[model samples]
Target: MKFTSGPITRPLKMGAYLKVSYNEKRSQVISWEKVNKNDVPTKALAKLQ
Candidate 1:
């Protein structure tokens, strides 16, 4: 998985995997993970993992 900070300037490709964690107190994302050209997790599959 690839991780990044700050905002993205372009659109993500199909099957891109992303995981994000937001910090409500700070009003921002505290953590992020992304895997380009990889399979994105389905709702059910995400829940299982």
Candidate 2:
């Protein structure tokens, strides 16, 4: 999924280069992946500035 450093201002597409994944466990199985970002969308970026 698309990733960003802040809340999404618009819909994002999957398989974005910004997407990240991590591992987690509860009992014996690894949980879902977590996504993060180092940058944000240009529209949102402009707004933030």
Query: Among all windows of ten consecutive residues in candidate 2, which has the lowest summed lDDT?
Result: 26-35
TM-score, candidate 2, is: 0.22
lDDT of 1 by residue, 1-49 (tens): 3434546555556555567788999977787678543455577457746
Best by lDDT: 1
**TM-score of every candidate:** 0.41, 0.22
Candidate 2's displacement at residue 28, Å, is 30
Candidate 2's C-alpha runs over 4 A off are 1-38
Model 1: number of clashes?
Answer: 1
User: What are the per-model C-alpha RMSD values against the true structure?
Assistant: 6.5, 12.1
Model 1 weakest 10-residue run by lDDT: 1-10
Cα lDDT of model 2 by residue, 1-49, tens digit:
3333444555555533232344555333233233443455667547645
* lDDT for each candidate structure: 0.62, 0.43
What is the Cα-based lDDT of residue 28 in candidate 2? 30
